[model samples]
Target: MKITVLSDTHMPRMSKEWPAPLLQDIQDSDLIFHAGDWSDISVYEELTSMGKVHGVTGNTDLTMIRGILPEQTIIEAGGKRFGLVHGHHGKGSTEANAIAAFSGEQVDCIIFGHSHIPLLKQDGKCLLFNPGSPTDKRRQPQYSHGVITIDGDIHAEHVFYDSKS
Candidate 1:
């Protein structure tokens, strides 16, 4: 199924709105996954209009908001097993070894967002994905944000959006 993947958006603090490019992807997607660090649930509410949204909470997600999201999420979609998490204890800001920790979940795919970086790779039997931060990009030269699609083949593409007129 087409999945609009996003993560690590600090929102309102980093940018005013969601990226424009992502809107198209979200519109075309059958489902949407937001890895974490939303800063507010309003973003999640807005994105749900795009499609079925599944999300988790980040480290900065505050105690009040913490109860709203689970640290890990598991979903079965299109005959695929999906494991979702914010990847907090997994590792530091940006670390491969840290992300690898989720590889052991025995899921067909693991979707996570932490460090505001997007990554997609075939690690063992699972496709690990991170859509990075749409709002809180921390100066990564790529400065990118994107989504992941899984059907016959696997895809992880960068989606740049213009939130301003």
Candidate 2:
């Protein structure tokens, strides 16, 4: 199953809209995972037009968005367990601490976002991902989104779309 991973989309604030290519990918995906910092619940609703969305609340998300998405969510995708969080618990302050909290949850991967930094890393036995920001591309030049391929070999890729265009 191919999963579309997105994060730090500040909606009307960050970027005007989701990239057309990413939106198309979402429609073609088996599932959609949003890391956090959506800033608005409407963003989730809009994204749902693409596919099934599983997400968490980021630091910038309002109370309502928080009500909808948990601080962390554990779900099964592509025959593997995944833990998705907003990473507001300290910009991934301690990987061990975050993983420890999710240790007994039976997860094979951990997906999180915050700091508007994109990351695709293998931490020990799990894959940790941060999809960066499609809008908040301050730190890095890559205004990006993420794609996770789970059919044969588990893989994570960040697709940096030109924000200017």
Candidate 3:
């Protein structure tokens, strides 16, 4: 399975649409994981039009979005357990908060977003991934997202670009 991960889109506010390259990536992916701060339900609608989307609600999401999405969730894909969160709940730093969200759960990977910073690391037996913001790279050098490929083992990497337009 090929999964495209992204978050902090903050859309129509960030951009009216996905960047050309990002859009292509989304179209080509087998699944999509949006960690949140979508800000509008239209973003959900737009993404769903392209493919399956598993997402959590961010602190900045509209009420309707919050009503439809959970603050955190876990899904099984390609025999791997993925814990997804917006990383705004609980205490401490965003990364800490995300880890706390699934503290007692057995997840192969913890995927989160809140700070709009791309991250890829190993947390013991689990993988930690934050795909950053393709539309809102607040202070990062470039816009970015992540791709995770699952066959027998899982592998992930970021795809960075110079522009969001």
Candidate 4:
């Protein structure tokens, strides 16, 4: 399965649409995961139009989004279980907070977003991934997103670009 991951889109507040490269990635993906901060339901609607979309509701998300999506959940794909969360606790280190979100869960990977920083790492038995912000990079050097291909084991990578235009 080819899974395309995105987070912190903050659309309309970020961009009206995805960049060409990211759009192509979404078009070619088998599954899509949006970590959160989507801002508008249209972002979710647009992604769903492209393919299957599984997502969480962020701290910044409006009532409609929060109502429709869970703050955290688990999804199974390609026989691997993934923990999804917006990863915001409003206190200390974002990464630490993210890891803590899935502390007692039995997920193969924890996928989250909040700081708009791309990350992929392993801690103990599970993998942690933050796809960053394809639309809102914040102070980051480049816009980015993540792709995970699962055959036997999961192979993940980040595709970084200099511009959204």
Candidate 5:
């Protein structure tokens, strides 16, 4: 399975449409994960039109978004358990909060977004991934998103680019 992960799009607020470079990845993905802060329902609608999307609602998400999406959830993909969260609920750094979100759960990976910083590392037996904002890179040097491919084993990587246009 091929999964595309992203967060903090803040769409329409960031751009009227998906970034041109990111579009190809999104289109090629078998599944999509949006960690949150979409800011507009159209972003969700558009992603769904392209493929399956599993997402959480961020602290900044509109009420309509919060009403439909959960704050956090776990999904099973390619025989691996993935814990997903927007990472704004607890009293700590976003990374810490995300890890805590599934403290008692048995997840192979924990995916989150809130700070718009791309990170991919191993935390014991689990993988931690944050696919930074393609539209809102913040202090990062480049716009980025993530791709996770699962065959016999799982592998994840960031796709960075210089432009969001």
Candidate 6:
């Protein structure tokens, strides 16, 4: 299964629509995961047109987004468990907080966003992945997202580009 991962889109605040690269990835994937900060529910509707979407709500999300998405979620695909979170705990580092969110959980991977800083690393028994922000890169030089291919094992990769569209 090929899963496209993204987060912190921030919608009209960041861009008018999905970035070209990310849109293509969404079209070419088996599933899509948004770690949150979408800001608008229209973003969710747009993504659903491409494929199945699994997501969480972020601190910046409004009532509609929060009503539809959870603070965190767990999904099983290709025999692997994925934990998704926005990592905005109204506190410290997003990465560290994300890890803590899934602490003691039985997940093979923890996917999160909130910092707009791309990250991919192993944390104890789980793979810690942050797809960054495709439409809102913040101070980062490139806009980015992630793709996870699951065969017999799980493989996660970050896809970065110089432009959002």
**Which candidate do you rate higher for lDDT, 2 or 4?**
4
For every model in order, what is the number of clashing pairs? Answer: 3, 0, 0, 0, 0, 0
Q: Per the 3 Å backbone cut-off, how many clashing residue pairs does candidate 1 have? A: 3
Q: How do all models score by TM-score?
A: 0.83, 0.90, 0.98, 0.96, 0.98, 0.96
In model 1, the clashing pairs are 20-161, 20-162, 21-161
The candidate, 1 or 6, that scores higher on TM-score is 6
**Cα lDDT, model 3, residue 105:** 99
List per-prediction Cα lDDT, in the order shown.
Answer: 0.70, 0.80, 0.93, 0.89, 0.93, 0.91
Clashes of 5: 0
Ranking by lDDT: 3, 5, 6, 4, 2, 1
- Report the lDDT of model 4 for residue 107: 90
Which stretches in model 4 have alpha-carbon errors above 4 Å?
Answer: none
Off by over 4 Å in 6: none
lDDT of 1: 0.70
Model 3's TM-score against the true structure:
0.98
* C-alpha positional error of residue 137 in candidate 2 after TM-score superposition, expressed in Å: 1.0
Writing each residue's lDDT as its tens digit, candidate 5 over 4-43 gives 9999999998878777767888878889999999999889
Residues 1-165, candidate 3: write the lDDT tens digits.
999999999999988879877888888898999999999999999999999999999999999999999999999999999999999887798899999999899999999999999999999999999999999998999999899999978899999998888
